[model samples]
Target: MSKTNQVKEDTKSVFQNKGSRRNFLKYSGAGIATAGILLMGCEDNENMVPDLDGVVNLGSGDVGVLNYAYVLEQLEAAFYINVVTNLYRNISDVERTMMEDLRNHEVAHRDFLKAALGSNAIGELTFDFSSVNFNNRESVLATAKVFEDLGVAAYNGAGKLLQNPDFLLIAGKIVSVEARHAAAIRSILDSDPKSFAGNDVIDANGLDRAFEPAMVLNAASTFILNKINASQLPTS
Candidate 1:
C-alpha cells in the first residue's frame, strides 16, 4: 500500500478499536502502541531510531526535530480523539464541531509527518493522560489549552534547529496551524478573544514563546509514558 494509504489504515484501526480506549485517558482514553512494544522486532535495522534500554532516541538533525514534532502531534491527536468520542458533559454543538475539526487537523499533522519521515519515522508513542478528567468540560478545555499552547511553542523552538530549508519550511507551516489551534482554544476558554497573538504566549517583542527541545520534552514527559532521548538533537 502507498504510504499515505497505509497511514490512513493504521489511524483508522486505532480510531475503530474501542477496546484500546482505556489506554489513553483516565476516562475513556484510547491508547496507541508504545515504542517499546513496536521496536522489539527492529533491533537490527540501521535506519530505525536507536533504542537503548527501551529509551527511544530522537536521532540528530532535521529527522530528530521531525520526530519530536511527530510525538507532539500524536499526543494532540489522541487527546482530541478521546474528547470527540466521549464528548464532555453538556457540550454544545459548536464545541463538538470544534473538537472534531481539531481532531482531524491533528490527525492530518500526525499522518503528514509520518509519511514525510517514511522509514525514518519513530514508532508510535504511548501517553498517560490520567491527569485529565475527560468527563468534565472545564478539565478537557483546560487541558486542550495546554496542549495547543505547548505545541505552538515546541514548533517555534524547534524550527531554528532544522538544517534543511524544506524541513524548516514545513515546520513553519505546521507551527502556524498550531498557533491557530492555540488561539481557538484560548478563545473558547477566555471571555475575551485575542486570537493567535494572545499576550500569555507572546512576549514584549511580540513573538510567541519558544521552548527548547529539552524544556518542551520535560514538560511533555509527564503525559508521555515512553522514554524519549533528545540528547542528540542539534543545539546551534
Candidate 2:
C-alpha cells in the first residue's frame, strides 16, 4: 500500500506487459526499423561523432543535448539493472529495494527522452564499465556518485541549449529528481546527508553549477563509448 510498493507493482506490471514477444518487438524497434531508417536519412549526421579532439560534439542544438542526456540515462539505467540482476556482495534487502526503484526511475527517464526525441535520439550505446567492480560496495557507490553528479551538471549545462520551454521544464523536473538520487546515494555511502550538497554543484551564491553542453559532453565522453556531437551547442 506504500508508495514504494506501488512503484514496485507498477514496474512489475510494465515488465509483464512488455515481456511478450510481440510487445517486445513492438516497443524495441522491430516494427519501427523502416520508419527509423527514413528518419535517419533526413537527420543531421555531422554531429553524430564527437569533435576532432574526440571530447565534445554538440550534434545540433536542443536535440543534441537531449541525445546527450539520453546517453547518460542509458548508462545509468544499464548499470542499475545490472546491479539488481547480479545482487552484489553484502547488499541488503533495503539496498536492493532502493536500487530497484532507482533502476525503474532511470528506465523511465531513458524511455521518456527516447520517445520525446523520436528519431533525433542517438543510437543505443555500448558501455564499458570494466573499471567498476560490481561486487564491491565502494566501487558501486563511487560510480553512482559520479553518474548522479554528472547527470545534474549535464542538465544544468544544457539549459541554454534548449530553445523550447517545454524541454527546459522537463529537464528541470528530471534534474531535481537526479539531485535527490545523488543525495540519497551520498547518504548511503558516507552517512552524510549533505555530502553531495557542496560548492562543486552548489555555488557560493547557493546556485548550482552550470556548464555549456560542450564541456559536459567532453567530460562524459570518457565514460561513454559512442561519441557525441556537441559542436552545435552554444560555447558561451
Best by lDDT: 1
Q: What is the total number of backbone clashes in candidate 2?
A: 7
User: CA lDDT of each candidate?
Assistant: 0.76, 0.69
Q: Who wins the TM-score comparison?
A: 1
Q: Mind sharing the TM-score for model 2? A: 0.74
Model 1 over residues 24-74: C-alpha lDDT tens digits? 222112223322123222222343456888798877767778889989999
Worst 10 residues of 2 by lDDT: 30-39
Q: Which residue pairs in candidate 1 have backbone atoms (N, alpha carbon, C) closer than 3 angstroms, thus clashing?
A: 21-29, 25-29
- Give the worst 10-residue stretch by lDDT in candidate 1: 21-30
| lDDT of residue 148 for candidate 1 | 93
Clashes of each: 2, 7
**Tens digits of per-residue lDDT for model 2 on 51-93?**
5654444367666777778888898998888778876798988
Candidate 1 TM-score to native: 0.79
Candidate 2 off by > 4 Å: 1-58
Model 1 Cα RMSD, 1 decimal: 8.5
